[model samples]
Target: MTDRGRTALDTVHAQLDAFNAHDLDAFVATYAADAVIVGVAPDPIVGAAAIRAFYESRLANPDLSCTIDDSVLFGTRWVVAQEQVVNAGVATETIATFDVVDGLIARASMLKA
Candidate 1:
């Protein structure tokens, strides 16, 4: 992997760790100021404030935890992470595609796996 790919993977891992830790500040730090996020259920969320709110609401659930199953790189700027998310005993497989720019997430698109 190139240096950018390594950094992109690091960013994803950091995001996951921060999320599991329920540290909003750390999680938000992984994203760009105008980052765009698209998830399974809701419409696209743009900007840091919207992303923070979205995560803040979901992070309230104590059972929210993510287990990364696999990851593949697309050049140096993107990564596709397949993860299993368990919350309140319900598990969902998610495939998230992250576009990393300058070591921060610029866009994220998620799909059901």
Candidate 2:
């Protein structure tokens, strides 16, 4: 992998770690202020504020921890991450697509695996 690819993967890992730690501020910091998030749930969430709300609600769950299972780079600017999310005694896997711009996530899209 090139340096840029490594950096992007590292950024994605850090974001996932922050999310699992329920560190909202840190998680949001990985994204651009105007980042667009899609398919977080059944509905598409847009912008950092909306993404933060979704994450906040998820964090409210007593058993919410997401683990990244795998990540693949489509190009220098795009990546797809397969993750397992555990909540309320249930576990589900999902695929999250991310678009990186200027070393920051500019967009994200999630889908059921």
Candidate 3:
């Protein structure tokens, strides 16, 4: 993989790690200031502050955790991952796509896997 690809992957990994650890600051740090996230809610979550607010409620759930089943890097900026997420004792399979820009996530989209 190219350095850019590796950096994108590393940023995604850091987001996942911070999420599982419930480290709000670290998780939000992986995203750009104006990042947008889709599929997590009815409307897209825009900006880092909004992303932080969204995850804050989610991280409050002690039963929330995500495990990656597989991941692939598409070129240097896009990453797609199949993940299994457990929230409130219910498990869901998710396919998440991430767009990384300048070492941070610029956009994220999630779908049922």
lDDT leader = 3
* Ranking of predictions according to lDDT: 3, 1, 2
Winning candidate number (TM-score): 3
Residues 1-113 of candidate 1 have per-residue lDDT tens digits of 12344478888898899889888888888898899998854688998898888889787778899989999988887999999998888889999999998888999998975
Q: Best to worst by TM-score, what's the order?
A: 3, 1, 2
For 1-113, candidate 2 gives per-residue lDDT tens digits of 11244467777887888888888887887887788887766766767788788788776666888888888987777889999988877889999888887667888888876
Better of 2 and 3 by lDDT: 3
Q: What is the lDDT of residue 73 in candidate 1?
A: 84
TM-score head-to-head 1 vs 2, winner: 1
lDDT of each: 0.86, 0.79, 0.90
The list of candidate 3 runs beyond 4 A from truth reads 1-6
Global Cα lDDT for candidate 2: 0.79
lDDT of 3 at 99: 97
State the number of backbone clashes in model 3: 0
Q: Which 10 successive residues of model 1 have the least lDDT summed?
A: 1-10
Q: Which pairs of residues collide in candidate 2?
A: none
- Give the least accurate 10-residue stretch of model 2, judged by summed lDDT: 1-10
